[model samples]
Target chain A: MRSTCLLLCASSSASGGGMEALRVFAAAVIVVGFGLLATTAVFSRLQRNRFVAALIAGGLPAVATGWAIGPGGLNVVDDSTVLLLRPLLVACLGWVGVIVGMQLRASLLATVPPLLWRWALTDSVLSAAIAGTGAAAVLSWWFLPGSFGIETALVPTTLVACAAMGWSPETRSMRVVLTPSTQQMAMLIQGASGIAAAVAVAVLGVAAQLIRLQPDGTPVLDLRTAVVDLALTAATAAALGVAARHLLGLARRKRGALLVVFLGTVAAAAGIAVDLGFSPLLLPLLCGVMIANFGRERLASFELFIMRAEHVVALLLGLLAGVLLTPRIGLPGTGLVVAILAARILVKPVLARRTLGPVTHGDANRSPLRFAPLRQSQLSYVLAVSVVLAYDAPLTRTVLTAIVFAGAASDAVPLILGFRRHREVAQERRSVAGAEA
Target chain B: MGERTDMRLLVLIARSEAAFDPLVTGLLDVGISGATVVESRGLAAVLRQDLPIFAGLAAFLPQTTGSRVVISLCGADRLEALRAYVAELPPGDRPLAIALPVDSFFGLEPTS
Candidate 1:
């Protein structure tokens, strides 16, 4: 009896060791796969777009392949892989945010009063209404009906609301969709979207507490505490920005000082945010905005650095998203998927047109303006928000993953069509000018 | 030397043949007529598998886009004309012009 018991313990220990080894091996494979994808992506400059498309196309099938591979697909990977990938994704996002923030700095200051006020009001109201309604509906139907009570629904809804509230305009894509005439219209739409996103996040936090039936029904961190934390984060970023501006001023004659300062500040802001448990995304953006508004000469210098960093980050994030996406887990029910598509494709664009009718007309007749296509960057923001949502509600992770994949697919067609239209318009203009000449 | 003078070489490097017509026509309007256009591949134009090797070979290879390069060598006397001409041609933020001293040349005779 004693010998039998000892034998059993020895066998169990051996099995544990084998399992650990398998996990490490699986992690190694994923790292290798990611590295290859990143390398391929970076090297293929013109082909980068194609490569990304291919990767996304392969994602669903790859998930299916994982499922076919059995227990190794579901259980072989460790938590550490997720941990490693998260920072990389955050860093990439931080870099993009910095670039965006830099671009918006000038506009933020130059924006007219009525426009600014309208934007503030519109964003706050729309973001709150959309996020609140969506959360309520989702919670009532999905969570409340299941084992999850209001408490569980509260956290998820808050997460969704926060995501809904934080919209970053896709400036890069806007250049594609509308001609110069529609730029202001585009900018207005983008501005409103961003404000809405921010307000949504804040309201969601408060609403979550209320729904959770927690004492005070407010964020555990009071308004004062949250404000202080936000201020500290902003202050740190500002100080870095100022330091960068001064260093840049002193080294105005230096060839690469601008690059150094730009990179150093971006990295520092992102790192600090990660360490402090604050939003890494917002800090870089704020820093960018501050620098853009204050440092005119340095702006050009900062742009180059930001672009290089953005490319690196975008590639890394794309690869990670590809690796982590499991189509099986978070596949939204057909109804939900259709609803999301309808909201994004039909409802959102129509609402945007109604809100921005005059501006769109103005854009059509005028010079290549800043903003016309209100829908610009909306897709990317929606995708990013979906990912953020996934982080909070692990169950929806797969669905969000699918959404990103599908969004990418749908986006490609519109982009191509828009590009072709622009080309035709440009050609027509040139011919007319030639005829006159 | 015929004259001790400074001259500018204006080069138009384009990715497509379609771009060549506008660029050349614009240059012509600025009194620039003759230019040496070459075809070469750009760094970004290289294939993915060939990038590492291309980066290594970049030092040895001439800076070419495989697209088209138009080079106009103007005399020192024509500097102002060339500058005005290039300026009017297209708005490329980067400098596409290089000033080099003409030591000697043995090509065509000067126009009357």
Candidate 2:
């Protein structure tokens, strides 16, 4: 009788905990829905302003809203809530991966300039080296110290480096004021950004698969296991891709069925990656590449449907980042953010000019679009969020914070610098008019 | 190409598909019932599709759906009312209209 009573008591406690968790999860969904709706309404009206649109595109407002309502601020979206929403977050990560990967159509990439690839490769290498060094130094000095080995240090290092590699492709504000020659340069920069995004994620995927963090936070580099996991992920992605293609092809006539198929495919892929300890970003990415290449024109509409939700996915990831943020990035974390900001602002532009200057026949060296390298890519935020989802450690959270702060600050650099030039040009035009009068 | 008549053929090219509903409603409000609407694709879209290199220019172009072409035949008095109604429509919804004298009429219903 006593043993039976104990079992009942334990079961009741478990049930109570589950119910409490459900309540928290439901409340979080409502808050997120409200935030998304509010952001959509405001952005719809304000998107005409290029700067505002850029911010919206970067998911900054969503991030800010998330931060305001999250544990760091209101303690509403707490740790337990985020833990429960992990699957949703994983699905979003997969969505981003697929979207980025679909742009990698072989034919489209064939037309891309060779110089752009060179620039992307060179930029990724250099940024990784610089950011990786800073990450190592900071991690060694303050965060990791003696307990964890170099493998552990390398995880956040890879993250920061990848985050620093790409420049923002949103050059609308710059293009409006650019010469035709400079505008072409902007296009080249934008093309390079697209390539760099793929490179960043690819690098992140390889690094993540190779490094396994032990239960006690000790990172172990297991080459054999990594290879096996990678092979499994690729195979799984290929199978899922083929299945999704067939499903999408069948459901083409019915929009409702098509949407359900797409959602189910993403969830399955994401759930598999999460369950098997695969990089969520990589599995769906490879799947998207398959869909893009093999599915061809039949899947074009499905790809478009997926692309349409890119912004919402980005916003959702931003919200996840905000809720997961610890807001306790220590001195080392602050240093990492400042170091990243400095490197992005100071080093990235010089490197870009030196490397890509010849491609534009030195036009890039003279144009305001030259400042484009200072802005961080929107993909950088996606990269940071993926790391948070995979790890959810204090170290990963700090990296996310650093990347977010650095990216926002870097995005502002070009705009602020251009503002002075714009003002001067306007004044010159006004003076000419006055002189004529 | 024919004798002067009271009928005018109004060919309107609306800027976007979204404007079609309001455009047709306004036409009805002005007492014109019969009209033909045809889907159209803009020149830029054609150029972008035909010339892959021009796809790069898409980023700079303002996003817009291909226009709609609307053709209607009505009496001269109804044409004047149509012009006034279109003028009151929002700038974005306002269609580019070209009215020609319907030199000859075949089968049509006449509203007093």
Candidate 3:
């Protein structure tokens, strides 16, 4: 027994040495990512250009890591690492959704339904078809190859199609950066995105059902369950809205109490979601919408608190995405990247121009709704897809990381340029108006 | 107070151009003139500083820099005319306008 123990210790020590080194490396990456993010935050605050800050803080580290380790850099952290972080990620997402939900409520009231709704429908259809088709083509060529026959491709394609509805929080981010004046446009875009996402989610659920077959060829995610789930999600959202209204009334009387209530309600909802096997994102979004649209005036004023929390969560999510990138998943084929970029930049803009042409012209004098074009949305979609893809192919974790990195990069450049342009135009207009007067 | 006459005053507070054009025009249409305007900043506005130089010194200094305050004093008989004018002004939360009674005024012209 003593001899056996000695042998076990020797072998364990050898493995420990290698594991310890990897752990240190992972820790270093996390620290560096956080440091960069902190720097970006500080710089952003000083400069008052949050878009620039987001790019620097969230984008730079992800790109550097992706370049160094290739697509699979996140693999170094191991599956166990992701497993541990998953709950935290879910919690963070929940909090973010809540905050967004609150904001959405406020924005919805200000929206002119017919025009905004029309834009949303158009964007959703175009984005989904383009993104889904692109993802399907890329994944088929690279991962599936000859593995999928036409029948099998349907499920994966559906998954990819639904995934195509992904959009970045860029519009929301822009709202934060350009406040008061641009609020109307921001609210419209947010409303459009929310509607589009809902539609896409519905498509995804349908697709999931279509593809879900047993070993002998039966169905999973039965239609009844899907319907029930949908109903429940809607009901939950309504309940959340009612609750927020009551909470807001309470909050008005005792200012700080809302924070505690907000946290508690979210925690309970998250728990319920986990138990019920619901789309965790939907309920919180509903809650946010309800609060923003229907809650008391005082609750609307407490939006700053929710926004602050969203920023922190978004930062953390970006950092985690960075750490998750591994060489295998990170190394997206150049063709695929180009295709994704093209779909977002070229195809999306064209579609947007075509669909929103009438609205654009009519509202030329009024504020233009600034949807964070396909490029930004594509990055967010890619990140979400990468994470979803990771469930099946562990190596895809790197791709998710790369998505975060690329998104940070792509989003930063355009946002900074856009912001500068917007600022200049504003200044020019102010001067012109001043001169006119 | 002697006759208990109705009156109106057009009060305006703005940093930019004078927003009292409509009010003034409306008041003129109603056959009222000779208003007394006083400019002062609110306590909150006066306490605000461009740069937070010294937390301690902030209490000593006024809250804001370059704030314009205008109070229009008119005859008590023009209250109806003033209410209509104030209602037409652009609405906002801060830099508000309020109408209060004047018990008596000396050497004021009666509306023609």
Candidate 4:
């Protein structure tokens, strides 16, 4: 009897080891899948078709891919695995924010004409507000029957609004002849104006996240707390940026070591943020912006480091987001969300064209002005998705669904408008030929 | 095209900013992987930086100060191909391309 009991224990231990090995294999597969998914989506944007760009850019495919492999579908990436990997999600987001920070240079803002600033602000802020407020009202009303309140509605509404905002006036596909000075100047003014607006509003959203009210009044003086939060976030970013910059500079000589250091920095930032109550994105973002602006060499090094790792991280986070969205928002609810996204798409471009009208005082026939098409790329999508994951509530998930759709649609907008214009021109030319006959 | 025995450096000064892009594409066509771009001012502008007296003459010049200089190192066999590519730059005032022999390059030494 004693020998038999000892033999049973040994068999159980062997089985346990096998289970552990299986877990390791699954985790590796998921990581690799995420990396490949993200890389594919990133490369897909290089193609000319805006629809394809939008589909991939929305990260919808990645999310769906993740869901297919998650508990909701195949039970591959179980709940425990996702929960364990939360820190990784934060790090991926932080990296995306860093790329965003790099895009918005201090010099770009400094050089922007005051007149152009007026229009860009209108396109970025006002349009976002209109979309957010309208969506918030309708959705909150719809979800009010459930366990939803005004406060609950605010986050999703704000996120969707923010995601759909930012008009990019740059029509990159259109050929511009520089003979006409007025139109050339108009095109140049509208060039980065939309992107600048998007950057400003995104930073504003970060500021919004920092300020929250508690019923107990334990967190007093909202203004003071916001200031403190901003300062802390800035300090964290600066320290990490400076440190990472040094690592990157050294990395130039030792490429392998550089990859290791970059990974360490990302992990460190995410770990620290999770320990504190702060969003992991804030520090890395501020760090990226500060470094990019201050040190040219640092910017170059940072880009090289980021260029290697960003897509992988984004893919990982996007995969996690797919798993996290287990509870479905339902068919009708999703439709309403899609409608809100559509409203934002409709309103923003019209507002953008109108707002910039003051800046563009020239005849369309004489000097055809092409305003930068409202472009929503990695920044808008990444920021909104990060918020959804950070908040991780039913309402936030609903908002995430909408934001991803809108994010994808934004990429396709330029193509959609261009195709329509081409059709219209063809029709007019046919009509002219008929009249001559 | 393959591993090189001798290395040479090609320095190109493009007259137009637009010409620089076509030149780089031309280099890539002939299989040059690495190059550096340095934005530079015209000789008059450089002289103005040295002595402010030439600053007044900026109004007279066409303000063609924006220029791109591209530098790339290539294997000896590829030098003729690069020269041919540079010579094919479009009909306008194009750009100037010069080649120099490199001796004992550090990290840049070809595997062959």
Q: Which predicted model would earn the best TM-score?
A: 2
Top candidate (DockQ): 2
Deviating ranges (above 4 Å) for candidate 3: A1-47, A50-78, A103-110, A145-221, A235-248, A253-256, A290-298, A327-336, A354-374, A378-392, A395-402, A405-437, B1-112
DockQ of each model vs. true complex:
0.04, 0.06, 0.03, 0.04
Docking quality tier of candidate 4? incorrect
User: Please, what are the lDDT tens digits per residue for candidate 3 over residues A363-420?
Assistant: 3223323435443443243234322422333324433443444454456555665566
Off by over 4 Å in 2: A1-42, A213-218, A298-300, A355-367, A435-437, B1-112
DockQ of 1: 0.04
Per-residue lDDT of A255-360 in model 1, one digit per residue for the tens? 4666666657767876676555455556776776677667555343234334433333444444444444455533233333333343344334444545555455
Encode model 4's per-residue lDDT on A103-172: one tens digit a residue: 4566545655565555555555665666666676666567555644444455456666655555333232
What's the residue-level lDDT of A74 in candidate 1? 59
Query: lDDT winner among the candidates?
Result: 2
For model 2, which pairs clash?
A: none
Give the C-alpha miss distance for residue B83 in model 4, angstroms.
Answer: 20
> Model 4 residue A332 lDDT?
39
Candidate 1 A-chain TM-score: 0.61
Q: Model 1 residue B45 lDDT?
A: 33
Error of 4 at A98 (Å): 1.3
Interface RMSD of each: 15.5, 9.1, 16.1, 17.4
lDDT of each: 0.45, 0.69, 0.47, 0.53
